[model samples]
Target chain A: MLKIDCKDKHFSEIGKTIRESKDKEIVIDNCLGHRYIASGVGGKDIVINGTPGNALGSYLDGCKIVVNGSAQDAVGDTMNDGIIIIHGNSGDATGYAMRGGKIFIKGDAGYRAGIHMKAYKDKFPVLVIGGKAGSFLGEYQAGGIILVLGVNTDSKTNVGYFTGNGMHGGKIILRSDELPDLPPQIISRKANAEDLQEIEKYVQEYCSYFGGEPKDIMEKSFYVLTADSANPYKQLYTSL
Target chain B: MAINYIYPVYEVVRNASRCVNCKICEKQCANGVHKFDAKNGIMIADESKCVNCHRCVATCPTRALKIVKSDNTYRENANWSAESMKEIYKQAESGGVLLSSMGNPQPLPVYWDKIVINAAQVTNPSVDPLREPMETTVFLGSKPDEIVRDKDGKIVDNMTSQLKLSTPIMFSAMSYGSISYNAHASLAKAAEKLGIFYNTGEGGLHEDFYRYGKNTIVQVASGRFGVYKDYLEAGACIEIKVGQGAKPGIGGHLPGTKIVGDISKTRMIPVGSDAISPAPHHDIYSIEDLRQLVYSLKEATGYKKPIAVKVGAVHNVSAVASGIARSGADIIVIDGFRGGTGATPTRIRDNVGIPIELALASVDKRLRDEGIRGNVSLVVGGSIRNSADVIKAIALGADACYIATAALMAMGCHLCRSCHLGKCNWGIATQVPELVQRLDPEEGCDRLVNLVNAWTHEIKEMMGGMGINSIEALKGNRLMLRGVGLNEKELEILGIKHAGE
Candidate 1:
């Protein structure tokens, strides 16, 4: 494993140093507020000691990244085919426009997490927020799975307002007794046995990343929010 | 539902002597404008269904067809026009926002027509492009501030990202889903033949066109559709579509009907689902955020490709261009208000954004003043009609010109402004199997190549006439240009002297 101390290093330098590494497994120390460190990087294992900046694993493909501390906004942005596990909480847009891959945040997430995330064929991105999430969660989500655990939060609400706004496809699993005031475009339901079984792999994997009992976490009734895909398209111009 | 609506603006007039009952117009009209009335035993024209696309006229074997403006008129008032009244009627009936296709049809100021070029007089002699070498080749990207010489006296070049073009023109972005697959084929083939690039627009690049990767510039928009590792790697350059001039500050919505089959697969969205590109990239709320995305694309491609940020030419266009220049982008494309779109709100298309001519001049001046002109290349796109428009754009401080409407016209688009309907009979902007197949790629490519070839030749001749030898010499050389029928303010904005000065 190639280890480098990224103290006082610019985002570009960190990116370059990480890029120059020949080792498949690399460790970054003192990774304070450095943005776009492993952006579009894949085929390697990256372990971050401290907070990495926004857009940390943007466009990431087929790699595994572990963050010892919290991460900034836009973590795992538009990332595809990768695994990013953040031990601490994440900021806004945790999985912004992510098409594929799985991002496991150990704690609460800020606003707009999992916004515009999509899935195609076998590439279904899974973003599991361990704690309560902020407003506009899963907004305009075309596809993919976003699961918010609400693990340990004092807030009465599991998630914030405008959840799943303008969402067209995919499934959002929220582990909460009741959902917040939702938009007209979205529908929420209690997770059935089939739904629980469907998210079993992700729950198990998320638990592996940040220790938790799968049975206890999975026991609670999960709220599944989805876009009303039944909304038919109307021509704004002329009908004929 | 209220049923009474205004008749179409035009009437399809058929010459009886030339009408052979071929029924080609009846068969060819995608809008169902013409149909053989079996009960009447005659082909009847439905004016309301006609978009005035001229598909019938063009395809008429004996030149039997002509579309004339209907002699229908309400109480004519300049303030409330017939179209406005019709629009009100439309809204009252459907309660739907008025959506339009292509550029603004309103009588807005077209700065291109008001600008003119100066010819070589007594002091300077015009060179013959045929006899002498008049270079039209342009290299788009960052240029070195100053040349460095090595100990051996060889000039060391620092220019890393550059798109070498035989002409100062390129086909602007028109996505596969927005246009037909055959239309894309024509553009790719033409770009390859012309040694210029064609943009993939916000639409994802089709799989078959991956072979034309060398001539393609893949686009990443807010929707992030079909943007993957292979797609990013396929393009010679990548463009982040921040905004389009036609619909400024608003996202794009490709209706579900257009997303069929391969288009659905190419865009990576579900078949027949609306492909909505949000107004803002949720992550990018600032210039710094744009820089991050730019760097991400660069890192993805190992920094081998240049990143271009395409933004609408808004009121703060110069400042926006400056920000993009500082945003780690190698190229900046400012699409002016006259630029075409697959679909945009009619109000937004007509009212929003400034003209390209004004935006280009302002951006060039601002960049030059900021001493960052060499940091990024400027590409101007918005109704670049002919060689003169391209030359004028170059003089106004553009490295290259991107032509979408002009290119489409060359590929047999009559500009009916009905692209939103997705029933293009010319096979240019539809996804239906029959319509998409109507545009033969070979013929499309030939026409496109022919158009650009003529434009380049004209550019060379015009450059020669100005006593200019190279595109590099002519670019941002405002002295060679002048404004005609323009006020002092217009002249000042255009950075040119009046004609006969």
Candidate 2:
């Protein structure tokens, strides 16, 4: 394991050091506001301390990024394959357009979490927010699994307003009985045994990283939000 | 019968004298407009189904068919024209947004027509392009503001990654879902042969065209479709599509129906999922945000390829372009309102953005004033009609001009404006296997090569007439341009004098 101090280092310098280093397991300390950390990088275990900036692990391909502190906007953006575990809260667009990856957040996430997240073939992205998610959560989500546990929230609804607007695919499972005001296209129902079974591994994985019992978290009634058809806006156009 | 039946816009004219009853027109039309009446021993026409793509006219062995605008009347009113009435009827019946293909069809002012090029007369003799060597090759990327020297005082290579084009022309972005596979193949082959680039748009690169990576500009839009490390590394340059001119400030939704097989595979989506490229990149909101994306892409690609930011020529396009120039982008592509699209809302397409001509001139002047012009190369597109337009664009401060509509025309598109329906008989914009096979890639490539070569020759001729030997010398040389029928404000904005000034 290589321990690197990023006290006065630029983002590029830190990135260059990581790319050039032969060490498989590396740790970055004082990683404040350094964007694009481990972007498109693979085959490494990167652990960052301090508040990392936006786009952490963007286009991350087959790497594991563990952020000890909070992560800013656009965490795991367009990430093809990887695992990004954030111990603290996350900013906006936690998993923007990510095709394949697993992003587990211990605390709440900001707006547009898991927006436009898609799935292809065997690759499916899973974003689990232990705490509540901000407004416009899972907007335009094509495919993938987004689970908002609302770990410490007092309110019944974990997600904010306009949830699943323009969503065409995927499932948004919230551990709450009362549902948020979802968009017209989205259909909401209680998570069946099969649905819960499918996300059991992810829930267990999230609990492993964030420190919680999967059974305790799964005790509540989870509401699943999904769109029926893949093409929600199919009838919105008239050929001129 | 429905009371809101609008008359067909075009009428099929089949010449009885020239008719050979070959049934080629019926076989050629994908819209099913023509049919053979075996009992009548003749061909029947469905004018209502006609898009006037002229595919049948071109395919007819004996030149027996033609399409003409209908002479049908609905009382002449300039305010509420026949087109307006038909559009009203369409919306009233469907209760959906009227979607159209291709560019804006409105008879708005085309600045290129008003701008005229200058030529050397008595004072300076013009160089004959045939006798003298003329340079049309252009390199697009950021240039170092000043020369850097090593410790030994040796001049170091300060140049960034640059795309070398044999001519100042490139095939603009047109995705696989929007166009046909054969059309993409043709563009890729032609771009390879021409030493230019053809953009993959936002559909992502098809696996088959990976070999043409050197001549391709892979795009990343709001949706970030098909964008992985390999896709980014496959292209010569990566273009970030901020906005499109056809429907400025709006997102692109390649309908679920068009998402089939390869298109779905290329986009990395399901077989029938709507590929929604939202209006704004959810991650990008400000110039600072854009810089993050640019740097993120750079990091992903290891800073090897040049990154381009493309935006529609909206009212504040110059300001937007200036921001892009400072956003670590190596190239700024300004697409005008006349840019083509597979589908867009009719109202937004016609009424949203500004012209490329004015936008380019203003952006060039602004960047130069800020002394950051060398930070990024300017590539303008929207309606570069011919070689003349290309030359005019270079003189008006463009490193290169992107051509899509013209390239589509070279690939046999008749401008039928029915691409949204996916029934393009010319095979340029359809996905149906049979319809797509109509456009032979070899033939299409040959035609595109011929068109580009012809345009390059014309550009050289114009450059020779102007006593300019190299394309780089004409970059931002607005003194070589003069506005003929433009107002004072227009001339001022274009940074060109009126004719005979």
Candidate 3:
């Protein structure tokens, strides 16, 4: 793999170097606060060692990104197709507007994860967060699948407040009791046998990436949140 | 229904002698304004459904059809006009905020008409553009605040990236979802042919138009729809849409009805889903935050494409512009209230932002005062009407101008102002397969090219009349402009003298 030390380089310079490289697989080391790494880049397997900044793997198309450490906000934003494996926690708006991708985060995530995730044609994005998730999870999501495992959290709640607010499509699988006091527009349900089957492949992939027993994880009570189609936010616009 | 409360605003008059019994008008109207009367063996009209798009009038074979605004009148109460009463009645009928397409039509002072162009006299001989070379070419992007040189004492060309336009006018951002694929294709093809650029609004670039990358400016808005790495790299320049002029603070809303087929793929959203963009980029809470997003785009594009920060002409727009100038934006596009849109709430569209003339003047002056004018090129647009308006805008310190409604008109739009209904009989805005097919991209492109080509030549003529062959000399040449029917306050804001002075 072609390796580069992005310790003190500006993000643009580093990005330029990465784009100019003909190597199919690349490794970036010592990534600090430099943001927008691998933005709109595709067709490569990028491995990052240190903590990458915000918008990591943003707009990443048809690539594989392996982040060894925690990442900041907007990971895999509007990503079309890719596999981003993050071993550590992530910041807010993770997987924002993601359309097609598999974002496997081992640790907890900040607010607004999978916000506006959608799918069209054969493209469906699947985001799996290992630990607990913050509030407004999957807000305004139109399609795709989001799974928050809530693995090893000391907190009482698995997912935070206002989860699935303005959510129109897609399914959010939370590994806990159904969230309470959400917008009346959401339809949260206990994942039954058929529901588990629907998410079986995604669960298998997440378990493989983050080291978990599939049966043990699936055994836990899971809840799915989908927007109520009958009330598709007519109030969003002013009435008269 | 109870009182025949509303009357049709327009009436179609057809002459029997000149009119052939052809069903072309019935076939052309998407609004169902014309129908063939089977028993009578003649064409009948449903004037209430007519939007006055003139499609039927234009399609009449023998020039037999004509449309006129009906003398439809309410009681002569200046306070409650006909349109206002109709609007209230419509709202009462259907409890929905009235949505309008195109620019504000509230008789808000059109500064373009108020401003007058100055011509050269005996002292400065005017050149004939027909025979003489009048340079209309311009480059829109950040220039170095100060040129730096090495010990060799040679000046360095360290300017940021710039978009070189053969003409100073470019087709503004009109997304794929808002306009038809044919409209976008026409614009792209025309931009390519004209050596200018067309914007792929907030809607993502259609995959077919990727070949026009050299002439496309892809836009990233709060929704971040269709923004991918490839999209970021697809355009010659990237525009970050902070605010749109038509709905200043509000975000774009493409009703789910219009989101179908390739539009779904282009925008990466589901079919028949409302694509509502947030008003603000959640990541950018401040100018410092704006800087991060700006630099992020630059990084994503390898600092190759110029980054433009587009904002509406709000009260403190110039202040915001100064912040954008410092935020590493290569270009700042200030859109005034009169800017067009696919759909916007009528209230907001009519009354929200400042005029383009004042905003452009203020931004230009502010940038020049801060000595950061060279740091970003200023492109102003909102109802840029003709060559005179363009010349006026350039004199007020705009590097270039953007025109949308004019381009739409050239593409067979009749400005029926009912684009929100998506039944564009002229086939400019609607997405219905039949209506879309009506606008053949090949024909549309030629018309657009002809329009811009005509405008470019006219701009040259105006520049020649001013005894200024090069557009660069006319940059911020406010002395070449004079106000006619404007107040002192307007004159001060425009930074120009009275017509006689």
Candidate 4:
């Protein structure tokens, strides 16, 4: 393991150092809001301490990023394959356009968490937020699974208004009996045993990282939200 | 149905004297316009279904068929034209937004026609392009701000990555789902042969065309479809599509029906899922946010490939372009309102954006005024009709010109203006198997090469006439352009003088 002190280092210097380093396992300490840390870097395990800035693991291909402190916006932006474990909360668009990855945030996430998330053949992106999420949580989500556990929230819903607006595919599982005000295009239903069974792996993994009881979290009432139709604009236009 | 208010816009004129009863027209039309009546031993036409694409007229063995616009009159109302009334009737019946294809076909003023190129007459000797060396190759990207010298007293080469084009013309963005596979193949092949880049639009690059990675500009729109690690690094440059010229503020929704097989696989979405690219990149709200996305892409590609930001030419395009120049973008592409699309709302397509000529002039002037023109390169598109337009764009401060509608015409599009119907007999826009096979990629590529080669010759002639031997000398040389019958405000905005002056 190669430990490096990121004190008073420029973002580009930090990036170039990590890219040129031969070390397989690297640790970054004293990080202070340095954006794009470990961006598009794969084939290694990176552990970051202190607050990491926006786009923490953007385009991260087959790497593991462990953040000891909170992360800013666009944490896993357009990431193809990776595992990001954030011990604290994350800002807006935490998993924006992530195609294939697992982003586990111990605390809450800001707005547009899983916006435009999609899935390919064997790559299914999973984003699990321990606490509540902001508005437009799954806006325009095409595929992938988003789980909001509402770990310490007293609110009635785990997500905010306009959740799953224009969503065409994938599932948004929330640990709450009452649902938020959703757009007309989305359809929500109570998660049955099968639905819960499907997310068991993600839930167990989330608990193991954040120190929670997976059984207790899985036994709670949950609701699933999905788009009514993949073809939302079939009747929206008249050919001329 | 309430007396059938709509009427056929075209009339099929089949010459009875030249008719051989070959049934060729009936076999060529994809809109089912021509029907063979075996008992009657003749061909009947459904004028209502005729898009007037000229496919049958061009394919007829003999000169036996022609389509003419019907002289249908509706009281000759100047305020409400026939097209406007028909559009009203269509909306009343379907209750949906009107969709159109191709560029804006309105009788708007084309600035390219108003501007004239200046040639050396008396003082400066005109060099013949055939005799003298005329360079048309252009490099698009930011040049180094200042030269740095090393301790060894050697000048360090600080030039960033650039896209080198043999000519100032390039094929514009046209996605695979919106067009056919053969069309993409033709464009990829033609781009390779011409040493110019062809854009993948927002549809993502097909696996087959990946071989042309050196000449491909992979696009990353709001949807980010088919955008993964490999896709981002596959192209020579990456374009972040903010808005399209056809529909400035609206998002693009490729209907689920068009998503199938290769398109689905290439875009990495489900077979029937609608590929929706929202108006705004949700993550990008400000110029600072745009810088983040730009840097993120740079990081993804290891700062090897240049990043371009494309936006529609609107009322305040100069300001928007200025902001983009400062946002770390290597290139700024401004698409005019007359740009073509497979589908767009008719009203938005016709009324949303400004002309390319005016937009290019103003953006170039503004960037130069800010003293940051070297920070990024400018590539303008919307409707580059010919080589003259390309020359005018370069003189108006554009680094290069992107052509889509003209490129499609070179590939055998008849401008039927019915690409939204997905029954294009020319095989340029449709996705059906039989219809797609009609456009042979080899023939299409050859034609495209011929078109660009022809345009390059004309460009060289125009440059030689202006006493310029290279595209670099022609860049932002507005003094060589003169406006005819243009008002003071128009001339001022275009940064050109009157023809007499």
Candidate 5:
């Protein structure tokens, strides 16, 4: 256990030192508004005891970053392949435009969660939010799987307004019976047998990461599955 | 029933006595209105083909030609006029939308024409171009904040890389798909010949044209179409197109109709599918994110090529430019609202961004005030009409100017503004087989070479008239320019003065 107290050091500097260090198990204490912490790391186990700033684990290749506190906007942005476990709530644009990787948030995510998240062949990205999300949850999402589980017992609606706008491809699973007020471009339905089969691995991974029973969450009831319309962007711009 | 006869609606008359047979008017008339018939003793006029561009009237040596509306009559129906009915019938038959090009040429106020330039007489000493070497060559790159040297008394490290050019003029990006192959060839050849650079608009570079890589500025837009390692490494510079002047808030859509064999292969998309470039880059959400992309591309290319960020000249452009300058961009290209495009929504095209003049002035002033002007170079474009406009642009603090419409005009565009129809009679804008064949690359390149050469001489003459020798000396030299009929706000925004006041 290597513990480093980042009292007054800039987040970038501390992150650089941590990344350069050969230590596998590292703990960063008193982390206050430090940006790009544990960014672009290859293989390391980083635990943040305090609040980290924006762009946490950006372009992370193969690292496991666990944040004890909430993070700022653009957490795990464009990360290729990594695992980010946020214990608390996150700011807006969480997992934004992520290409590949898995991000597991124990708490809620802000607006535009997984916006434009994409995946190529053999590289599928997964983002699971334990609590509710704000508006425009998956705007312009081209590929990948995004699941929002309203584990916080206070609310039932896991996602907010205009969800899945301009979504051309991909699947979104919401652990809520109430259908979200979505745009006209997206088609929403109860999780069918086929949809459940597809998300089985992702749900199992989410359960494994958060130490929750996958059967308990799955047996409770319906999941809202959203996909883009056949002609999602047909009339979005102009008549001509 | 006998058909009602109507005389000609308009007559294009030519006075043979005043005609000098120089053919300047004939050459200038791109609409094929006037042509010399070898079989006949006099020049022949075609009335139906005339769009009344007045090029003949402007270029006639003896003012020999005149245009008049003929006193012809049709069944006077205000809503269902003969022309309107014909247009409706054509649309009903073809089932196609109407498309136009260039600037809004329908009697709209051209701010460029309204604005005028000033000269130095007795009050300020304009340097003599004949005696002194006027510095027209501009280095577009980041400048050093503080020089660092080693103990050996030699300069060790500089701040930013510079793009050196012989003249303060560049060919703006016109993608391969948007224009014909011959047009791209002509532009590429001309840029190589003139020692300037031409931009390969977001379309990927063809394999054959890679030899002109030194003279090309490859563009990367949201779609990331044709963006490969080689494409990034193939150019002298790379431009990240955020938004265009013609349609600021909209993305690019190459209709399925234009997606031919080579274009489909180059764009890496299926044929008959619309090539959609999203409005915003999926990776960039803020200025810091934009910085990341800039650096990422730099890293991908090993920092050898200069990276340019091209944005529309919108309101608050100064602040936007300030952000871009600090965002590690090497060059900031501010495209004015009047820039040309192959296709754009008419509503957004006309109403989206600010004029180039005001945007350039504001951006230049903002960067200079921050003392970070050396951090990035500024290139302004929208509608640079002539050499005079180029001189004025540089004096207003632009490192260079970009000319697309002017270049098209040199290649025989009639300014009909019907490029979207893809049936350009002049062969300058269309990609149709027949229309494309009209423009020969060799001849087109020669004409472009001739146009720029003429403009270079005229630029030198203009500099000489101001007694300034080089373009560098003329940069931000607003005192050499004065505004005519411009208000205080216009003068302040343009950073110039009223003529002779």
Candidate 6:
């Protein structure tokens, strides 16, 4: 257990120092509004205590970032392979455009959560939100699996309006029985046994990380799946 | 013989008496509507092929041509015109795709021609370019908020990165795979000669063109293709391509067929696989994330080269520009929806994003209001058609203009817009061995040089006409422009008054 006190040092200095150090289990305490913490780190376990600024663990190849407090926007943005555990609320665009990683958030998220998340071959990105998400969730999502578990009962909807807008590819699993008010372009259907099977591992992982029973999370009544049509979008202005 | 009862709905009348044998109209016509019949000792006209671009009418030396709608009606149904019926019949007969270029050339009310340029009459003395030294040279980089001086009260060396241009024009990014090697060489050579810059669009720089590094703006896109330590350090500046004008929300895709030996090696992609750049730079999500990449590139290159982020002009572009202004980017390159692309899904290309004029105006206004205009310089592009458009763009508030499709046209692009087919007969767009050979780099370079030189002269003349000498003085001086036949909304968006009124 290596604990580094980041009381007043800037994000750049602290990040540079941590990156150079060979410590595997590191805890950064009192990290207030510092950006790019644990960015581009490979093969390390970084535990951040305080509220970190934007771009937390960007381009993270292989690392585990556990943010004990809330995080600003763009958490785990474009991270290749990593496990991001956010114990508190997250700002807009959380896990945005993530390629290959697992971001498990235990709190609510701002707008555009998991927008543009994509997958390549065997490497698939998975984002699990334990709370409600803002608008434009999974927008233009080419690939990846996004699961939003509506744990908070205060909000009327699990995801806001225009959810899955311009979503060409990818599977979005919502634990709520009520279907999210999506755009006209996206087609939604009840998740079958095969769909639940595909996301079973992710749900299991989320449960293990957040200390919840996987069976309780999977016991939800229905799952909504949204995807764009095969020959989606016409050439409106120009001749195809 | 089956008699085709196709009536000419529009007659292209050419006055033989006023016609001159100069053939400027014939040369400029991309639709091949006009032809010079040497055996007949006259120019012939083919009205059937004409889409009525008016290039011939506009460029006719003797003003010998006019296009008129004929009363040859097929039916009284105004909903379906004779032209529309002909178009459907043509599509049915050909079983091929429809192609068009330059923009939605439909009568969408071009706001540019409506706006007018103002002149200095008596209040402000218009400096003459012929007499005084006019400064068109623009430095595109982050301007310091406040100059930090040393103890001696002399200027300190704490300035941010910037790109210096001899003129306010830059050759915009057209990738090696998108265009031929000869075309790229031509642009590189011309940029070197003219003291401007040419961009290496996400496809990494070719080793042969490294000698022209001084005038190169290397791009780093989503896929990080061709991005290495050496590639980053090669160019004068680095541009992070988030989006392009042609396809605002979509990524670029160079078909597998075009990715050859050098392109494949440069892009770091396997041969015969589509070089697809993901829509978003996977590493970037927020403004702060964008800053990391910006700083990363800066740190990678030892902060020697200025970093630019290119994005399409979308709604809320002003807010986006403000974000980019604070994103540690030295320069912000905003591409309008009217910009050209090598290959984009036809739908995405045409229907995405706002026009350059509106975007530029709003961005400039917003930055100025925020007092962060000094943080980054504006580089506007997409469809800068002529010297007049360049002048208008600068006045609308771009520090510099990027000309790609126009530059290619100057180097002899027929605007066939068949670049996706990769069989460009003009050698500007295609990578085919035989087709590529058609364009000589030296000649193409010369033509580009000639085009820029001509535009420079025209710019000077327009400036002179406005009684303004330097381009620096012309930048953001919207008083020089007035909108004609424009509504209040259009005029307000353009930041100009009605032309005559």
Q: Write the per-residue lDDT of candidate 2 for residues A1-240, one digit (tens) a residue.
A: 988888998898888888788999999999889988998898999999998999999999999989999999999999999899999999999999999989999999999999999999988999999999999999999999999998888867988888998898998999987999877788999989998897677789888887879899888898999997787778888888
What's the TM-score of each model vs. the native?
A: 0.97, 0.99, 0.95, 0.99, 0.72, 0.65
- Angstrom error of the Cα, residue A149, model 6: value is 23
List clashing residue pairs in candidate 3: A40-B229
lDDT of 5: 0.77
Top lDDT hit: 2
Error of 5 at B424 (Å): 6.1
Q: What are the per-residue Cα lDDT tens digits for candidate 4 across B189-215?
A: 999999999999999889999999999
Candidate 6 residue-wise lDDT, B77-195, digit = tens: 77786656765665565454444334433344455666677776787676677766667788999988887888999988788777888888899988888888999999999999999
lDDT for each candidate structure: 0.88, 0.92, 0.87, 0.92, 0.77, 0.78
TM-score of 1: 0.97
Tens digit of lDDT per residue, candidate 6, span A147-167? 888775466558888888767
State the TM-score for model 3: 0.95
Give me the runs in candidate 5 sitting further than 4 Å from their true place. Answer: A1-71, A75-90, A95-107, A117-131, A149-154, A205-217, A220-240, B1-101, B106-134, B148-156, B174-242, B250-307, B322-328, B366-372, B408-416, B419-454
> Which lDDT tens digits does candidate 3 get at residues A92-178?
889988889889999999998998888877889998998988898988788899998888886555788988887888888888754
| B1-501: candidate 1 lDDT, tens digit per residue | 434567679999988778888899988888898887789667779888888999999999999999999989988798998888888888878778888899878898898898888779889898889999888888877777788999999988766778888898999988888899999999999999999999998778888999999999999999999888889999999999998878879998787777788988898877777887888998889998888888878877777888999999999999988999999899999999988998888989999999999999999999999999989999989889999999999998999999999999999999988898889989898987888787999999999999999999999899899888899999899998888899998888888999889
lDDT against true structure, model 3: 0.87
Docking class for model 5 is incorrect
* Superior candidate under DockQ, 4 versus 6: 4
Better of 2 and 3 by lDDT: 2
Angstrom error of the Cα, residue B293, model 3: value is: 2.6
Query: Which docking category, incorrect, acceptable, medium or high, applies to candidate 3?
Result: acceptable
Question: Judged by DockQ cut-offs, is candidate 2 incorrect, acceptable, medium or high?
Answer: high
Which of the two, 2 or 5, has more DockQ?
2
Those runs of model 6 whose alpha carbons end farther than 4 Å from true positions after fitting are A1-7, A12-240, B1-102, B121-125, B150-154, B282-288
**Which candidate's DockQ is highest?**
2
B5-80 per-residue lDDT for model 2 (tens digits): 8788899999999988999898988899999999989998999999999999998999989899999989969799
